[model samples]
Target: MTRPSPAPLRVLDLTDDLGAHAARLFVGTGADVVRLERAGTGAARSRAEELHWHAGKRVQRIADEAVLDARIAELAAGADVVLESGPTSRLRTPALREADPSVWADVVHVLVTPFGRTGPRRDWLADDVVLSAAGGMAWLGGDPGAAPEPPPRQQAEQLAGAHAAIGAWLALLARDRTGSGQLVEVSAQEAVAATLETGAIAWIHGRSVPGRTSGIYGHVAHRVFPAADGHVAGGYSGSPRMWDDLLAWMVETGEAEDLAEPQWQDGEHRWSGRPHVDEVVARFAARRSVAEIAEQGRTRALPWAEVAPPSRLVENPQLAHRDFMVEIDAPEGRLHDVGLPFESPALPRPVRLAAPADLPAGAGWAQGRAPVTTRVPRPGTPRHGGALEGVRVLDLTWVLAGPYVTKTFADHGAEIVKVESSQRKDPTRFAPGMRLRPGASYDDSGYFLNFNRGKRSLALNLRTSRGQELLRALVPHVDVVVENFSPGVLARWDLAYDQLRDLNPEVVLVSMAGVGQDGPWRSAVTFADTLAAMSGLTYETGSATRPPQGLTFGLGDMVAANAAVAAALERLHRGEGGHVDLSQLEAMAAALGPAALEAELGQTVRPRSTVMRCAGEDRWLAVGACPADELDAAVRALGAGSLADLAAASDADELAGRLQALGVPAYAVRDGHDLVEVDPQLAARGFYTPLDHPIAGPVLHEGLVEHLEATPGALRTPAPLLGQHTEELLTELLGLDPAELNTLHEEGVLQ
Candidate 1:
């Protein structure tokens, strides 16, 4: 049977890396993309190189204002989806939606920027540094006295790009059922902040800033050590078993007599004496090549890998076998880049497009596109059937990573008590896009709403004696307490895990820090999401032609949050109570995954540009998605016609319908419409609800998490107004009488 036609995606391709990457991903996923470019920064070579990002897109250059305005209006009316970077300001989306609400409502508009669309810093100039610094990334990087380093590359921007892509996909999925679309605001700052790993978690628990350190590699027994050949690689000898295996391997190979004590033969014994073990391992490694050591280590199942450079990575065997790199033909030449890592058993390969070579000079580009055709619902509250149901989490996290992990648990089914100090609310409360009026409270921020949903908030002054008493009173009710603070912070607060364990031994505690609890640099440095950039993740991205750019958003923080969630799940599964030290840098380092393995083998890889040109226009094609033997046959699949013509058999709606008929996944890209208009996945999952807000009228909101055949969790009410539940909670949880509550309120203990 013939495959179904592709979907229609409309993108306002601002001349930025984030927007470019978003457009590129959309096209790769079988959407017919239309891109809008302007005159400024229109360098011929730069424009030519855009082909690497615009391969599957049709481009148009905006010239005169009159023509541009008319074309934009026409395009917005016709487009199914809309994506923009710098152009998305408070002024743009609302005005356009008002002009033709029906047409605009059918479009999923994604605004990508350094800050969100409505924050105090929304109008400020931003790239990586500004975003990262404002997002509190710089606060945790390098040494406290040293100049703050931005991510080594353009991280904030790349995170923005990734989120832009994800937000668009999610919006489109939402639109599939509700027959409308909504504006998706993405902030590079918030994205970066979101990836602070456990730093924020510790802030919630310990009220301290997580510090940074040099190349300690985080958690477990990991670090980058010099090999015999003057190359560096990561090695994990922290585990008792791994340490024992390494010693045994050395002894078995007849290389064990370098003056190390015999107690090193046992894993537990060695872990306690890391310094001695390090000295012996360093000496032994001085006589072996990285590859030889790595091979031998792998043979013995010891975690070790050489540090690899970008240029050499293009030919890395494991990555090649996994098809992690793709080559797209562009005007400049073929460009190589990292491809999507997530894969499904059914869909093995995604079609890659090369950017086009040229566009009509001064042609009005923002014209001719179809609108969103589906109306999927928003995702809702957690279901009772989740594995975490009945679990109680004492969420002491602020900012990003810690909050994010706890939020995931809340999304699933855990009851979360998000404890914060009024003196230091989560930065996001004041960071951006808070729909605050002249005298609104902290709850007005969209950032707070987005991450803290379905969680209870408790404002406590942890620095006060009374606050300490309150926490001690509350300890017995919680199953877990998670924090991300600098070393010694919780201990300083007299709330260390040991102290807490004395009160409730069954309670699990997870500590997230920039570095682990033990390391030479543990107290000397700080780190943030940008830690990924410094640890060679960014260096592995972008083209060799330019310095590696940071991912457009705070990916390191996000990845770390996922790791934290996974770790939490693991701990819960074991049903063992202990402290879990999650190092932010270690989590970010782990995202490097196989790359770490290759690095340990003493290989280096290069970061080649993915921007290129195609089809007499500027576009980017996947560098080598078409197999060597199937290139000619695949090219023939384009069917010798304009992309629009190839899609002529049906509009986006009919195409999706046909694809669904064939049991394949497909949907149209859409513009600013409603919360629900084009999300097929949401429809399939039943994840949206129309809720009436006091000010926003009846609007679509995210629905429930997970589907259960039996019992399920439910949200009886939306997040309560600030202080709305104060009385009930105080009366019930604290067993306070009305008169006592009034006295406490008068004493400023409760808001």
Candidate 2:
């Protein structure tokens, strides 16, 4: 028997590699993706690299004024949204807007650019490396002494596209309410800037520019210790209790005697002499295998795991049990990769993305292709609203994904009472410099300061019944709770989603577990934003076939955060706010939505060839993946006779146009110098927010995703200080009497 058609989503997929990826995500989400191919030769068709991103999209070719106008009319009349990565200047072109006058006010239009539509360089050309440099991500990677190395691959562009997808949904909601759509403009540079960890704050407040530190560990006390089997990135320092547990393990393992030495006796001394300290730890770890160290760490309740690559990650037990990784037979063969970024336990077919692909038209042509299965929403009452507003959320989310989602609610005016267990504190609180002292107020890790902005903080001990009781009492008064805990921790405290939902039926719980909460691989797996590398994303990145490299920023986590925001928005629309089983793994998978369809079809979407350097005079004029035949012609058209000759000509738009007119596919490479020099479109869009922090002065915040006609979300206040609004919230929202509030403070329940 034949199944019914899948549900529809409005997507305007523009030309380019990044746009292809973004469009694919919506396709996976069961959207009707319409890829707008160029009018003539359709260079995108020749770029096999784009096939992975275009799996579920329906190809529609349109060029020039007349044809585009008809196409735009048809699309705007039917589509729910439009996704574009071209210049806003292009959008403003009469011919372009004439085709879809309804697009701006009737449907969500997501515009993606290297620099936002309004920045000075909006018209400038950019490749992944150039945009990464402009966004400041390059400053924090690579060897300290060498030039700031570019990020691994297409991260800047890909991330902006993901954010653009979320932004589209937000605009769509507003359209659903107000009957008017707005422009959602995204800048690869700006999106990437948000993911630079604490580097921006360090330069702004600390007056220190964070230089590159390749192979150096992040601020968290994680390290890759030696084992008989392989290296493990362990020594998680989530809390003091965790540290104490680790110490106890060392003692039990007969390594405590080393701590008695003057060099290791004091925490400060040991930290100061990290070289020697690491040597000691390394020596001890060498005697054991990764399994032994991990097993001991797990049993002792210390967060520990070995650093694993993609090949190993697919087989991890924690991920397997949780169904974090799913296998769908492609047209060619069965392949394993990460599943959804979030799981709706309520959904009937949770693990399946779509049906598998049929046999290829030709042998090598279908070597790596798969059939996809699409989801059709069970006919039911559709829901809508501030699914999370009025719901008190105690955001324990830190870093990118968690905080960004909570921030979305905060933008919607949610009361987020954040809890910062002082024992280990948020790492961003001590970034740039791992400086933490008992009474230091300057301890603001730009990471913690910026992300925690607009939230109240309460110091508590979940291990203590008093703390747990306070949380329990607060839960009844709250509507939703969010956390990014490792697997199994919440269940141990009897405070998992089920327990919370049981106490409050309307409460919505979101867990940003690194892997997820279920599956054979659930507890056995541990990961961060780097999951992109393991999920076949990185496998198809770069110009070469070397082991896939990890992205420089936390794209995986941030994208997941956006997904949670979308889910919350969807829930709110349904008027039924309940439990949400969110997983970072799932979020990442959702962004790879199109790929899942392709994977199910058994197709292998190989990574594109990275353009390391161009055949030109200026080393900066890099052209990656330029078609073979067009290389020489492209060089001549740009007036660059050779690699050295390429330096003289700066503008690639003309060259791009010429190539397009001739039916050759090509895009100009960009970097820091180029970003600063050209691009006038971004300034017109007004995408940057200037901030003046009391400590970190002259900070620039990115503009909101879209400019709403009414009640647009804006940055009302900077990030808050610890308990800065405790008294205000107590008296204003809860109506607590001053005398009673004083009592609570004295009782150690209030900060």
Candidate 3:
């Protein structure tokens, strides 16, 4: 299959390390990017960071900011897109528009900042540690009743960069409709908060305030465990079937003890049976090698993986088979870089090029190709309120990761007809955030409500021929089809991408799974918790002294969801049909930033996280990635004796403020209550939007997270009720009459 190339774009990248990932993404998607900055400061901080971020971009540097605005406007004149970010605002679009409105007015310009342009904390001092805490990620990981630790590397900044890419694409799509350029404003803090998943939802929608559980899920052990050869992530205790299978294995091995008791068989009993069950599981794990345990667990269908560090990612079987790790062409020798987050035919490879060579002045990126054309609506055509107004998508997805993809676009006014089943519903419909309203059923779940908003549900049994025919018929009506079933499940039902292509040649198809459509572990039953461990993140999660803790928040969902949305949108922009084969494994691994690149070069893995106690009970402050100059002054300010004693006397907010005053990066970790109620930055951004649900009543939701100056999206409606739009959707999309709808309903194919 020939990979389809993205529409070629010219981008003037006026960003530092914070916006590096966005520029890299642009390059990967066939954009010609010129990295412009002052001469000395333009050099990357480290070698691996340089290779990972700037491999395929052209570089141009000047002595200083003298004539910088003039140069920026000149570059903007030739560019289709302009990108910038900040420790301080670069304000590229405003400056360009100020200088020459006619030239820069129609350019798609994206500006990414730590806190966004309008928020009160927009100018606050921030780094990885400060952003992590303020964004609500630092509140979830680490040990319970202790200071939460930020993830090892550049988690916050990288996530913001990905969101910046999403915003830029959305703007490009809008540009096609509006006949103008755009200002895409992205907030690193909001991007991190948007992906907190249920951590923030547990408070926003439900009254439940979830706290750090160390590495345990309620009463069960949820972290990595020991093996004779090495540690493995093996402490899952969910699902009745998994528990039964595990108990049987334990009993057969003469290690079951009293777990065979009748009461112990109940899942609720097992949840509370943690300490005892944890000891038994640990004992069993200690007796086996990681190889023995992983192999044996695989045959039994357990969510198990060897907890590999960054150094071992290249040798991972699934990754190696998928070619996710590739060598870079550097002047010195062949260096390594983590490959593209997703694999798709017709899309460009995530190349690792060397330091950019100097190009002639006024050199255009390509010989002579017109800018990608835009739709020009004739005079007096009604404008679209949302950028994706006419777009339609058939959503064959459930759970966290898949739902997130549709949710991102649905917010942009894309009409999504979600194909569900009455027989077997999406499990998240019954998961956490269950509202306390009376007479709640499958449709009453807050998890379902938050993720499925602005979607119409069509209940169809794919197991039946009539249902398959209906789905194939509807394929021609939609612009895209997205699904996350295990690899090949669609083929069995005659609904794979090939089948969809037969129905509509111009339809874009996106198939995402844990390990992707092709790989040794393609069919593995997996979840985000296990994907976390397998991505080499879990091995680097905890403090340096302790064994790495499990990542319960499941960041892989957001990573893959963002990539899938960006890829799908880019494909749609070309007005062509293509298939995006995405793997959550590669997606999550790619989010490790430059950690994998460093480890690939044989550098010793850096230590993970830092924690300091502060005033009040269970209160703490997180600080790290501090500059060398600030470290000593920060230490001296705190004075001699334990850090705990010094910080415990000062309020966390006040202490963080003082540190920030000294140019040291620090932030008091905000909890769920604090975030929704008192986080000034969140309030200033209007990040929390209230939605009135038919079942769950009125609740606050994370509305359109990005700021698009031209065509900002809306939370159009609450998530649909199960099978709520069955008849209406059929009639609208398929032109099915009332009689046909009733007949299908009678046959139990449409419910």
Candidate 4:
């Protein structure tokens, strides 16, 4: 079999840490990435950071401003994309845009900033913590009574980078058709805010604001429990089968108490009885080692994971088996860091490319080719006529990560066939505290309704041979197959990538397992929190005085979902089809790339900043360094003599607004309520769309994160009910007779 050619594109990276991940992603997809640095700039803050973000990219140093401007214009004329963070002083110049209109028009200029370029907070200076607080993410973690804490490391910056990467890819697809590249603006605050799961939607629809608590919200038994040897994170299921399995395991160890009662059979009752359940589980866990719990959990198919620090992550068996860690030899020394977020046979391997010996002067403008001719499809056509139109996706993913990946495709006009089974439905369908309507059924879950919009459902029980046969028949028709089941589940059902490839020669399969497919710990069960704990994110989050805690939301799931989308799109762009093994743990670790670099270089990773509280319950501010002029202006705006006086103020939003107007970055810690009610920027951008569902009526759902001008994505349909389109799909796609479908339904093979 012949492999598809790599994407032949040139990217100019003129960014600090903010947009590094975007350029890094382009490099991973086999683009020729060139890094431009100032002449007086020192080496990367650490050698490990440089190797992780810039290993395969060429670099050039330019000194004189005039020379730099001319070089940038020349490069812009030849480059396919230019990634820059902070102010766009160089890009907005007439000299660059006018040097070659055709060339400039074809080059995608991605501007990544703390806030979007046209927003009021655009010029405000912000670090990771400030951006997180401004985005309402900080309000989701830490104790309820104490000030909210931002996740450790630069998650806001990385999330922005991920969105920027997605935007760039979408633009490239558009350029492939339209021959015109547009600006892809990414705001760290907006990107992080979108990852708050259902918090924003809950406030918009339910008029209730959720605050940070001891454990993940809505999950009482899902927390890191102390084990004999070390800590282990575990989550109990609300499903009766899993709950019974857990109880049986406890009974085996003589740890079952009140949980053995008949009243505890109901999942809701078990949740309400969390106090008793936690005591019983803790007693059982304290006497058992982490290894023992891990084994038992795997045997019972329970969600359990051992809490791993950075050192353990370095030696993790699952990561090692999947080859998720790559070793690089930089000028400083040898270092090991997280590798590609996902692995694909068609994707290019990482290569070491040295920087250019001499900078190119302004001489290549006349030799550049005219922009490629392409056309964008019109909206409201079949498949919404968006970028990925005509592509067919078979979505077998449940919960956040897998559904989120397919949601991107569905939003971008791909025809998605979501194959769920009534036997093992998506947990989001039963997510606690989220109901579409009073007395709604299982399919009317608010979480499900939000995450699974714009897809057709084919609920089939894969355990049945006939149902598996039907799925096998559908595999040949789909362009891509996505699943997030544990490693061996599909293989057990004879529906793994190897089997699907035999049916469809060019089928692209994306398997997003928690630990990947072939690792030793691949069989270990995991949840969003467990993945965070095992990836060292939970260990690094929280203050120095507090024990390590996981993010209140599924941070790892969002990161992995974005990566999965990028992988699928890259394959489609290259006209290649192959299996993509995506490890959620690796995805989370890649987001913490800089921190890993620091640890690899024997440097202390910075701790979370202290929160500065003000008026309103849980209202606080995250302050970072600011320019002297901005600082002085902020003091004047707040009517204070010094920074200390402003910090002591009772009203945080007032001070934040005054400082923001003065071009200083300070934001009041916003909860879900603030985002829904007061976030004018999000409202102006139409980030939240009020989509009407049959069950949920009108609920506000998050809009597209990537803004494509020519072929913008949109929500076209509400989530499907269980087996809602069974008859339609069978008749239209499978050519199945009505009587045959009725027989299958009667046999309990189809729901």
Measured over all alpha carbons after superposition, the RMSD of each candidate to the real structure, in angstroms, is 19.3, 7.9, 3.3, 3.5
Q: Tell me the deviation in Å of residue 41 in model 4.
A: 5.9
Q: Which scores higher on TM-score, 1 or 4?
A: 4
Which is superior by lDDT, 2 or 3? 3
Model 3 error, position 19 (Å): 1.9
Full ranking by lDDT: 3, 4, 2, 1
Scored by CA lDDT, what does every candidate get? 0.50, 0.54, 0.75, 0.74
**What is the Cα-based TM-score of model 4?**
0.90
Q: By summed lDDT, which 10 consecutive residues of candidate 1 come out lowest?
A: 617-626
Task: List residue ranges in candidate 1 displaced over 4 A.
Answer: 1-12, 42-52, 87-94, 139-145, 237-239, 253-276, 343-352, 357-751
TM-score of 3: 0.93
Estimate, for each residue in 1-751, the C-alpha lDDT of model 4 and write its tens digit: 3244443677888877677788878766767677777776535355556667787677777778777777677687778888887543333333466666676787887778776765555566677788888788888888878878887777877888888888887777767666677777777778888888866866765566777875554543588787898777886754566677888988877788777888988777878877788788888899999888877787777888777777566687777766666666665655676677765443343433332234364334223444465543323235564767767889999888999999888888788899988788566775546553345567777678778899999989887899988988888778889999878888888888888888887788899988877766777677788888778788776445766667767778899999998887776655557788888888887776756667767776544444687765556877655556767776876677877566666687777776666666677787888887787767766777777777667777777776665677788888888889888887777899989998998988896
Give one clash count per candidate, in the order shown.
146, 73, 3, 3
Task: Give the alpha carbon lDDT tens digit for every residue of 59-119 in model 1.
Answer: 7766675565565666666666677676234234456667777767667776676445553
Better of 1 and 2 by lDDT: 2
lDDT preference between candidates 2 and 4, better one: 4
Candidate 1 lDDT at 303 equals 55
- Which 10 consecutive positions of candidate 2 have the poorest summed lDDT? 361-370
